[model samples]
Target: MKIQFLNQEHETKFQELRLGMAEYYRNNKEYLSVVYIMAGNEELHRKMNRYFNTKEGMFSSDDMFNEEDFSSGNRILAKLAVHLFNDNETVSPLDIISALDDEWFQLALNAIHFRRYGISSGYDFPEEKLYM
Candidate 1:
């Protein structure tokens, strides 16, 4: 489950995605706060609540993940990917193998990971894994 940049191009794309995601989060902190709460980040939820002087409301994980405003969905997916895989200097692609429960997140992670690493499964497979 290790993830490594396939080459310079892959590393560059990953860096670009990290920067874009950082910008997205900075510009949409409130929305992302809600997402973090729904993603089970209690510490983030508390920090956001105190920072924003607000409390959690009726938002659900589905609502946050399925947000259709601007590229919120993509941003949310990226945030989750960061949360789940941004540990260690190099991540094991297998780290995300068990996250197939959420099909959308799985798809998004695979897409992002593949776009940045030139591989989807991180494991051996007969056919080429291409994510659309």
Candidate 2:
């Protein structure tokens, strides 16, 4: 969605999410290729390449979301981002809403809501309302 995530930590986290999704598709090449077309800033594309090219093997979710690794958390975020970005009806806020559906985004949203409004998982606003 229309998140600025001005802070580097948040940005890095977002990137990690994207890399995670890309890695999944990378592993499922034949199936994923025909589905969604990935597009974003140059950095996002680069991260996707890195995750795709990463060596194949068994890795834990902790390892997948690590800043050092292409992380499952990151992949989760990426998958959400891709889904929102590809949706013709999605807009900026809707994109953020879509991203928040991811585990990483949920964590961020829960923290922010708890700190600012004392809410967790917050309100489940519809994507349609977000667009307006």
What are the candidates' C-alpha RMSDs?
13.9, 14.7
| Model 1 per-residue lDDT tens digits across residues 21-117 | 4343422334332332223323333322232221322223334334423243434444453343332123244544543335444444544544344
The lDDT, on a scale of 0 to 1, for candidate 1 is 0.36
Per-residue lDDT for 1-132 in model 2, tens only?
232332445445434543555454432422122111122223334454443332342222233234433344445434443333233222244545654445345543433332233212222323332110
TM-score of model 2 relative to the true fold?
A: 0.24
Give the worst 10-residue stretch by lDDT in candidate 1.
48-57
- The segments of candidate 2 whose C-alpha lies over 4 angstroms from its true place after superposition are 1-3, 6-45, 49-70, 87-103, 106-132
Candidate 1 versus truth, CA RMSD in Å, comes to: 13.9
User: What C-alpha lDDT values do all the predictions have?
Assistant: 0.36, 0.35
How well does each candidate superpose onto the true structure, as a TM-score? 0.22, 0.24
Indicate the TM-score of model 1: 0.22
Model 1: how far residue 2 lies from native, Å? 14
Looking at candidate 2, the ten consecutive residues that score lowest on lDDT are: 31-40
What does the lDDT read for residue 47 in candidate 1?
29
